[model samples]
Target: MNSHYDVVIIGGGMVGASLAMALKNTALKVAVIEPYPIPDARGEGYQPSYDARSTALSWGSRLVYQQLGLWEKLSEHVTPIKKIHVSDRGRFGATRLAAKDYHVEALGYVVPNEWIGMTLISALKTEPNVDFICPARVEGLKRSEQSTCITLSKQNPETGEYDLEPQSVTANLVVIADGGRSETCQKLGIEIQTESYGQHALVTNVTTSKHHGYEAFERFTENGPMAMLPLGESDGASVGCTDARCALVWTLPEDEIDAVMAMPDAEFMALLQTRFGYRLGKIEQVGTRHHYPLKLSQAAEQVRAGIVVVGNAAHALHPVAGQGYNLALRGVVALAELVSEAAGKGENIGALPVLQRYINGRYADQDKTILFSDKITRLFGDTSAGVGLLRDMGLVGLDILPGAKRLFARQAMGLGGTEAKISS
Candidate 1:
């Protein structure tokens, strides 16, 4: 086994990479073990290709990425969502959140996930204190009183598997960011509370006749709420003309998922257009669609002795409001702040108090986001008339009351929560 280090992060995904880059200039020796490479960073000022996947970058998250020096590299690919429109079709319910009203440049930016990953990778490359071991697979994990040991094997690209040749390393703190159902988290005997929503989210990109103009629409249909986020480029671009594009996240019942998947191209497009409405004009072309099963999972405890869980490994919320990444960003920011403060004080960076500080700081924010997302999904996803009316009324009430709207915007932007301030 290798000698003990200050920290060993298990996953090199967005949140993990953010944590590493956040501590890049610090004195702590940090190592990241990821089974896959981060992202390609070779691009001239991010002329973003039409990416199939994207995430809503909240203002709070944007600030963190900016501090990490990632935003400047990929900002051009982002489409600022200047307004968010929320409504239900059958009821007199509508609420609008405007960037100008919030006194910000824009409410948030819809950025391709690939760009975020690429930017994080670019930042990670410049850090000398950070040891990133990717294309390597973790074989085993063992925990001791003082440190946790991780066994890894080099991977073979051809076979798409790991070589048997093993190497071991130990760290004072082991952070599991391997995702929701993390093997390392399970190995540490952490219990996860999971709730299956029995729904599948269908995501795709579509070109519209009318430009979204950086406006995001969230409409509650009978099936579920559909989120339409503006995109920079269309899937099929034409010469001398720009194609207006947006990403659709349609939540469907599990029973209907197979049928939706089996639908012919035209039929599927019709269904999508009908649900999304004509506000964006007729949907001209639909990109390839994919579905993900919905679930809410939260870890019972984020810290234990020498271990800490961050990002999806700590909490997985419904993507209805697109709070998953934003919440993860919050946790990462909090963890980074705690670690930096402790290290600055010349204290043991991986000690129990430091780990506990992260957990205590993140618990309320993560819990609120999870509960709120779950509630939103349940409230709007229901087809019952009575429940639908209540949701509509809530929207209508928020619309009429300016103060309520700002408060809701604050929560949606992940700026105001009961948890400890991450940036301060």
Candidate 2:
């Protein structure tokens, strides 16, 4: 194994893997350190970030993937979201945003996390300038004047235990793209601002009696906001059933999650139908349900000497707007461009000035994205009469006004603000 490289990225999830891909054709040598083993065909292995969760990819995200030459491979597996219907449950205010209104083919695409992981892992394996350090953990990270020193322990293939002895890898730059709960950032004394939403998101796939027509629904109920993203048809049966399914993201109060999860299938479907209404028709079937607590967290410092943080390591926003991964990918694109420029100039990629440039370029977008997600979570989650009335008026205005709809669509599509080539 090489002892030195131009870049060492900690974490091989979507963001980190995408970074490696973005820099693959560049002159810099890159290594990705991931603790989890590569998932097998069944996806039953130990990758943390790759699960059954569905991700809503904005149009900007599609452009990013298209630039990376990954869109063709991924397009077949994704279901297009042609329209988004936003409404307040039992309220008169409802707004509809259509792809035609924005002069686009689709608003976004819905894809499973597992498929994305597999595709990225396969792509990274073929990159000549990239190295995969799977089943390996970073024990320690030290930043020096010249480079960042990383101590890693490789796991034993037979027993899945890390070796007693550790090896060191030194790189001109260390990029951290690990998820929100990053031990690496904590070890480096990077403080993060965090706020708990006192809510949990229940996720699952469900079959509807009627076709979804490639439309996404965001219905705000008294309990919380619930979203039904059209999945079209099921590609492969999960939990021993196959039907027209849509991915459901139901946000509920912390105390009510257990009771909801414990309900019988019929009872649960009934509850969902009641809350979600009959827009998509009856909830005929639901697969296994999973729940995770929601929070807003962002690293206080995104860049330091010899190191830069991206993805969830830098900011993990509420999923209300599905902006977390999109924002992370934009940051990855900006950082990659800056690093490539630095490498071309024969400058130290990890130098404070170089890293600061990346940070400066991304600060405004990050701030806006974080606040957008946070405000949506707070505003829609509140069921108070005053707030509801205000939100209803906002929704009505958004529907009636073309300019307002266009602005909201641009933001949702991640095309607002200073446009980057990667997001073009």
The number of the candidate with the highest lDDT is 2
lDDT of 1 by residue, 128-227 (tens): 7888776776788887776778888866868977777888899877888888778887776789989899989999888889988889999888887789
Candidate 1 residue pairs that clash? none
Stretches > 4 Å off in candidate 1: 1-3, 42-51, 157-161, 234-243, 418-424
For candidate 2, give the lDDT of residue 64. 87
Cα error, residue 151 of model 1, in Å, equals: 1.4
| Candidate 1 positional error at 259, Å | 0.8
The 10 consecutive residues of candidate 1 with the worst lDDT sum are 43-52
Minimum summed lDDT over a 10-residue window in model 2 is located at: 234-243
Model 2 lDDT per residue over 200-251, tens place? 9999989998888889998888888999998854333445533368999999
